[model samples]
Target: MPSTPGAGQSVPGTAVPGPGPAWFGAVMGTGGLSTLLQLHADAVPGFATGAVVMLVLGWVMLIGLGSGFARSVARDPQEWSRSVRDATMVPLWGMVSMGLLAVGSATFVVTEARAPSLASVAFGVDAALWGAGTVLGLATALGFAVWLISRRPAHPLPTWALPMVPPMVSATAGGVIARQVKSEAIRSILVGACVVCFVVALVLGVAVIVLAYHHAWFRTPVPVALSTTTWIPLGIIGQSAAAAQVLSGPSLAGLARVYSAVVLVAGAGLGAYAVFVTVRGFVARMPFNTGWWAMAYPLSTCGLGSYFLGWQWASLLTVAVLIAIWLLCAVASVRAIAAPRHA
Candidate 1:
């Protein structure tokens, strides 16, 4: 079931893209775009931006991130240890599950506002996709959750890490419910899932701000500043914000805008840092080796967030930038694959 051919072919998961870091970009990208689409649909009449964004994000995930990971695995089958393989596989399914939700959501949106005739069929298709995707994603996540619990991190656990599990579990539960439900039940379950995703994202938000502060206080700039790690979490935070907006409706309009603004600000600030790093680092004769491209993960995250947080102009800008970065990363990864193994 893994999409990446080379990654999971020989090994049960070799052709399957590693769910671990490979998922970080796709998950955050799709989620953020969906969130923004939902938000725009509510605030403006006949807004098509969200739908387009979702489609584009989906395509990018499949082509750029998915293919990139596949190549990475193909280069070295042993890189994906059994433990890491399990960890990555869970999220790969999670992405599939999310894709189903997206189709369903899009169907509902289009039917309600645009064409009633297409509604029934699309809705049904949505259900089927969501169901299939959910089953796969859930099985993977559950398996990984068990694996994670049994295993220990290399160092002492951070306080913030503790809260991550509950929200994640809650979101997965919501995915299951969303896939199985019908009528009014579907909306209710999705709303719940969005809430959990946002909660998880909020915790992540706090962590990012903390990291930014830590760097500032220590006067030691963390390297890979512009790469995917720093800005992508904000994108997830933005998606959660947009999801909260959609679920809550007009009654929470003010709160929704505030959340969106916060996401936009966070994204912009982090994006600036990334840009500064890229420029400064490049001009100072810093190596732009294959390793530097890894930042594409976080850059994609920030780009996704930019689009989702109602920052339309910025979102478009980031998407373009992220696409370029992603391509560069892909080339680099593939080159690494062709390079002779040192050992």
Candidate 2:
């Protein structure tokens, strides 16, 4: 068998180079954007208009950019089996993501631009669609986790990371109930679900990034591989947005905002780190690879970070940042497609 990255010297019968963690990470990473977008619209009244526009723009950036690299990486004949699975599922999630963008954007649009009744209908539909998408997304995450743990030979990573499924599912359920059921009696129930899912997701995302960082920084002898660290900003940005929504409670909200401040500040620090990494990459003249997509992910996180900060100027700035990323992704997609394959 060909040697795989992180291949098991861990156990017999265990498969090496399982796609589970990577796949799960991708799905959850996508949701980080989805939920954060919604949270932005929800928290900032009247800002929904801008939120919808930016959300669509961000979606375009992610899909167009992600598809490009996914295609490049999938082209390797050695990657055939994994590529097949990823290709099929990616499109499925893409459709779902697009549907989500559409519904979510429309929710904000109709709510703001149209009649209250119209907005209500849109919200109802949005709830259903968001709930279903959330559930499916969570399932995908769980599936990835399962795939990770199934390595007949054990990998050192914990199987619980795979359990990101439950939080996603719970969150979706909360969204659904919050939308569909009008009863105040159920409001508390739904709220609990939403909070649980969101909280669990936040913690898990942070955990993954931290673990990846530890592995890359401390465990590995080599300079921490940049690819593994790219997604850290996503969690940092996401946690900030989640923190903003928690502000409804005196104790919780106060604490949440404080926590969010820490994340925002950390996000700034990481943003600097990313720039340093990029400049270093340029100076070192690292070999070109699809891995450059890592740069864009952090940029997107920066956009999300700005969105979470909720300042009028900050949100607008983030939209501008998102637009820039969107443009970069478009260019990258074209290059990735036109360039000849080399591994």
Name the best candidate (by lDDT): 1
Whole-model lDDT per candidate: 0.45, 0.44
Candidate 1 residue runs with Cα over 4 Å from true position: 1-81, 84-182, 208-220, 224-228, 280-311, 338-343
TM-score of each: 0.54, 0.58
Candidate 1, residue 10: the lDDT equals: 23
Q: What is the C-alpha RMSD of each candidate to the true structure, in Å?
A: 8.3, 8.4
Model 2, C-alpha of 93: deviation from truth (Å): 5.7
By summed lDDT, the worst window of 10 consecutive residues in model 1 runs over 154-163
